[model samples]
Target: MSEIKHEVTKDPITGVETTGHVWDDTLQEFNNPLPAWWLWAFYGTIIFSIIYWIIYPSWPTGLAERGFLTGLSTIEFTSDKGEKVTTHWNTRALLAQEMQNDENELKRQKMVKEVAATPLADVVKDPTKSAFVLAYGKGIFGDYCAACHQSGGQGVIGNFPNLVDDSWLWGGDPADIETTIRKGRKGHMPAHKGTLSDEQITAAANYVLSLSGEKVDPELAAKGKEIFNTKGCSGCHTPAATGMKALGSANLTDKIWTQANVPGADSPEAKIEAVKKIIAGGIDREMPAWESRLSNDEIKVLVAYLKLLSQ
Candidate 1:
């Protein structure tokens, strides 16, 4: 085999050094140096990557228990039990530290404590407390109540009760609202299908609708009135059809419906059918208790917020 040789030369035309490589005995490769800026930029990236790896969690450790390389960075935060917790740097720990030190977060905590101690009536009267309740309570309501009552508290037609409306199954008083949030409510209307005939149920429904000023057959409504009083309906709803707040019975006099979608019905027949279906099937819905989930102060804020919304 012939010995391979390299010949380095300079081209007089461009005055650039040759790479000592030739092709086709004419074409020569130039030995050009890389730009200083490009070289520095490449080195800077390598340095940045090394620094990043040293400051944050990067490579996974071979040991399963150790997980990843935690790096040199650390975060300190006060735990709920008042213990100082120093852990490896993480987003959750960073947030906790921020919550403890943030100026706005500190102010919010102070306001929460102040609101918790104040009377519900006084809280509504005070401009500062009332404003806080409306602003802060909106977020709380959205987090918890909005899932059922909707974002604006308008409520779903048949699924949830409208908090924005004046009509309330339970009393709408501040104290009443507080109790409701703490204890929760279970609405129950026994099904009449087992005891009452189809005609009797229809008559009762028509009578119930008539109480709300809905036009119905006078003869059937009169018959229904008799059945309503005689049957157990009066026991919960009361004889006057004004409803008993203590029992969470719906007031028949008010046209606003909670369980039955009476307002949604287009035609008179559909309206009658809607009410009749409710009478036959009955209702069993519940508002879950928040006492365990939310703090007492949060419940108070929610009460004030809901009361304000209704107004």
Candidate 2:
């Protein structure tokens, strides 16, 4: 029987070589050594992983009482002081205590007084003080007023007066505004939509515009004037179509719009919107009760801002 012998060759560095075998008539696989950089990187990773495992809470420890000893036994981490450090997190409680603490009482009271005494314009004029007041106001406003007043203090007209307007349905006194804000306010005006037709509404709207002293389209206002009396809108709006605060009926005669007034529609448009809102929603404006929601000091800040609006 004929014998076939295997061939071998020594590698240059590792001194290792593959069994003598060739494919595709010439191709051969070689045994090679890994580069120093690659070898070192691999070792480094292993060492880092070991260190990380030791320092951090990994395996469970039986000595749970001693921070480090318990942690080490349980494979948990402990501070240098040999105690387990725990995080402390709480909110509302801290705020409540901070707000009422004897020391805090004076600070909180002072903050409220400052807010009440300071006009909004003046408060805003200062970068530092205004920023604090604004942030403080925003939280209070959102927490208490956002439900009815909306995020931007924009209220539903006829239901809630928009705080943005120059013509305030109620007197725009700061203290008064604060009182109205803190305590819920309800305004009632007889809905005129039922009695007034589209035509009379149009006419009365025009006349109401004239009350604002702004020039109205003579033709429309003339029509509006007739409807104003015909619809008996004067019963509550008065002969002048001016508001009767007693009934919380807004004075239609003023130029300052209580709600969003469609520009060109003037009196007619404003009346249409007001009438529609009045009929659909009924006259109910509520400034939320802050007694439960806001601290006494927070309400004072609100009063301050409101006073600034009028001043």
Candidate 3:
């Protein structure tokens, strides 16, 4: 192997020195020392960081008794808002104490008591109270409902109900919303595979689609309509197929076919299959109860927000 030779060069324009390193037979790395100010600044940061580590909560010693140093003590100071604040050496302890501040705690308790005492309907009717209810309810919804109904309350098709829409399986009353949030709801559609014929189930699916104003074979729909009336579909759906809110049956008149459509653009074949599958296998939608999870005041606030959605 031949030894590499150093070919140090200088630029003619600025007379800058090169580090004898070449790239693509053209560019060369400049051999320049960093500026004095930059060097000093870098060294300053190292010194400052060292001092800071000694003065603040930096080390994590395994020993529990003498693990950390308390560099700062509890000191009373005025805030930017002209309020006096007593800060503790430990951040977590300071935060815990802040949460129990006497004046703030009293105000929070008073607000909660007022909201609990007020009726849900009366709170919704009042603009001032409704504003508070909506703000508070939004946080509660984020904690509980957002997982299923989503943060915007626009639920996924076939899985959860879109709270923003006027369509509701159960009644859209404030009391109804409260009851639903507290006790939860379960909707079951019995499978027809064990009872009805395959052909009758297919016809029923097409007939159900036709009720939502979708185009279907008139002959199949006619025969399905007869079957629908006699085969117990009308028991929960009612004679007109308008759906019974008391039974939490879905309305077939509206074009809101939850299972038929999806979140994004989909093919017509997919919609048909979804409807047919529901007719054959049926579905059971259950909304878990929140009575034990949330307080009565929280439920009332959620009811107010949900009622406002349909309106």
Candidate 4:
């Protein structure tokens, strides 16, 4: 093999140094240094990366409990229990610190305090407080209540109650709504499968449908009305077929069907079957109490928020 020649030269045309690499005999490669700004920017990025790694969490230390480098940077914030907490710089801690010190957040806290002090009725009446309750309460609802009641609060048929409608199992009063969010509610309907025959159950279902102005069999409904009054249903539902809020009984007179998906039924027979199924199988549902989980102020905001939704 022939020895390769290495040469360096300067091009006289622009007076720039050449790498002495010829492509087509005359054409040469320029030995140009990187631009000063570009070189400094590159070095600056390197320095920034080093500083970032030192100040923030970066390298894995391979330790079990303390898996990563804690870094030199620290974040300090007041915890929920009113205690000062200092920890390694993290987004979560940073957000907490911001929430504590941010001007918008401070205003929100002040508004929450005002809402807590005001009565439920007054809170809804006040424009500023009501607006705050609606906006803030939406987030709270999405976090807590949306899981069960749905994002729109329309609820699931045969499971959760539709909150947007006028129909409320318990009373619709502000105090009642507050109590519901605080204490929670349990719905119970005893099975009549053992006591009443299938015919009686069907008749009772027909009567219930008729109460809601559904075109049910008159003779069957008459028989069912008797069974409804005598079979201990009227004790909670009342003789008028109107529910008692104190007992959390559903009103039969209303077109709204909470436990039974009667509205969803395609045919009249299917509708009757829906109600019959509830009567025969019985109903047992529970809404978990938020009193322990949520603060009174939060619950108040939720009550107002729910009321606004229903309206």
Candidate 5:
């Protein structure tokens, strides 16, 4: 064990003594003088603070210092008959009013009508107009459809269809597109977890490919056909089990698929996976309503664009 010792060292400038104890083996420190530059810097800061307090806002009073600007310019109100001067209104409020007044001067109702009235063909064909509209539409797409549909409008397939492609699950009419955009879309495929066995789910998926000119696995098709009719697919899918437009149940017989459309996916083996998920989990796609987020004009433009896409 090291023996303890105590000593006191006075500060060189202030003359205050250290507390009669040392902390470590080699290092020895004591209350000491502040550097001349530091002491001068401290005094300079104090002087600067006093000057700032006199010339600018500070504690001890609510009044603004003489040099501080409160943004309330002295407003002169001219008399109607040149008699009395009115009170000074705040400059900020006046600036705000002026800004609002000037803003309307640029694009008032007249300008919007003038812009919208231009024939859509003229707008679409013109690069300037098309660029402006596309730029505008990109922002709208991000806010409304980007949640379920991706930022690029490439939908999360097996649930939603790709808008870039030709296949449309529902009618691709402009009016239909508009209705779908405004209202939203929901596809109903009845759940068959307990209604059909794992074997049946596998078979139904295989049977789905036969409609698309894909060869069927004989063993799977035999089992799938029995499950399809017994499970009442024909109710919504019609007698041929092709499709029923009323319920929007897809025509399993068509080559155009609204769901997954990978290359060689029409094959029974490939389709079986898709069908199994649909039968076991059931597919549900909900496209949110855009009535609240977008203006009627914006919706109209979108409707026209979607219509043009299908063609």
Candidate 6:
């Protein structure tokens, strides 16, 4: 092996000093000192960082405390029990406090009062207020109603009511909708397995399908209709199969089957089973009361959106 050699040299063209090194026997690095301004700027950043660390909550000084070292701007005080506690000033906390100041808070309170005093019909007549109400309602729905009704109020079939459609288990009047949201609703359908025989249950399922104008076995539907009237189904669901709003019973005369899956043109069995299971086990649906959870103004905002959905 041969030893490699290095020496400081000058470039003939530029007359610049080299870094006493060469690459590929030709290329060399210039040996130049950094400019004073650049060096001072770099050093300034280091000094600033040190100062910032000392002035803010930066270092974890103790494992047991699970906290950072108290800095210059820290708020320190002794508790009622005489234990020392410290918290540092932060831009985020300052901004939050500023947001809750009297002027802004008063404005918000005024808006709430105005919305509450205004009737929903008149509220919707005003374009700006209507937009605010709808947006506010959508957010409230996402927070409270979305978990069960689903986002956008599409609702899961068989489990939750679909709000997109005009039909409603309870009346869809604006006041009714507001009442439902505030007080909530519970619908009870008694299990019929013990009350009716297997054959009657099958017939009842067929009769329910017939009410929806679906093609069902006429003879079975006839038998089911008779059983339906006698088995206390009409107590909630009226004789005409139009649900009673007072009881929150579902309407049977329409295509909407609350618990039925949307079956294709060929898959009628799936639709039948959906209704049959309900007859055997019954249907008990519940919507929680939001009176305590939400403000009256908030409920009105929700009603505004729900009315829009019905439209």
Tell me, by TM-score, which candidate is best.
1
lDDT of 4 by residue, 3-55 (tens): 44457888888889998776655667889999999999999999999999999
The lDDT, on a scale of 0 to 1, for candidate 1 is 0.90
Q: Please rank every candidate by TM-score, starting with the best.
A: 1, 4, 6, 3, 5, 2
**What does candidate 6's lDDT look like per residue over 46-73, in tens digits?**
9998998888767876652547764577
The C-alpha lDDT values of all candidates are 0.90, 0.59, 0.77, 0.90, 0.63, 0.79
Note the residue pairs that clash in candidate 1.
none
| Stronger candidate by TM-score (5 vs 6) | 6
Give lDDT tens digits, candidate 3, residues 1-311. 33444689997888999898776677678889899999999999999988877666666777634576545456454553557777645666565556556687656646655776887667768887777767777889999999999998988887888888878888887778778888999988888888999889878877887887777778888888888999999998998898887778888778776554522426545555677787788778998999999977778778777776657
Report the C-alpha lDDT of model 5 over 134-201, residue by residue, as the tens digit.
66556666777667666666676565666655455666655666677777777877688978889888
Query: In model 4, which regions exceed 4 Å deviation?
Result: 4-38, 63-65, 147-152, 213-218, 235-240, 244-247, 262-271, 291-294
Ranking of all candidate structures by their lDDT, best first: 1, 4, 6, 3, 5, 2
TM-score for each predicted model, relative to the true structure? 0.85, 0.52, 0.64, 0.79, 0.56, 0.66
Ten contiguous residues minimizing lDDT sum, candidate 6: 260-269
Clashes of each: 0, 12, 0, 0, 1, 1
Candidate 6 segments exceeding 4 Å error = 1-112, 262-266
Off by over 4 Å in 5: 1-133, 240-245, 256-270
lDDT of 1 by residue, 1-311 (tens): 33434788999889999998766666778999999999999999999999999998788988734688887899999997899999888899999999999999999988988987888789878999989989999999999999999999999977899998978888998889888889999988898999999999999988999999999998999999999999988999999998999989999889889877989999888999999998999889999999999988789889889987887
TM-score of 2: 0.52
| Alpha carbon lDDT at 142, candidate 2 | 74
Superposition TM-score, candidate 6 onto the true structure = 0.66
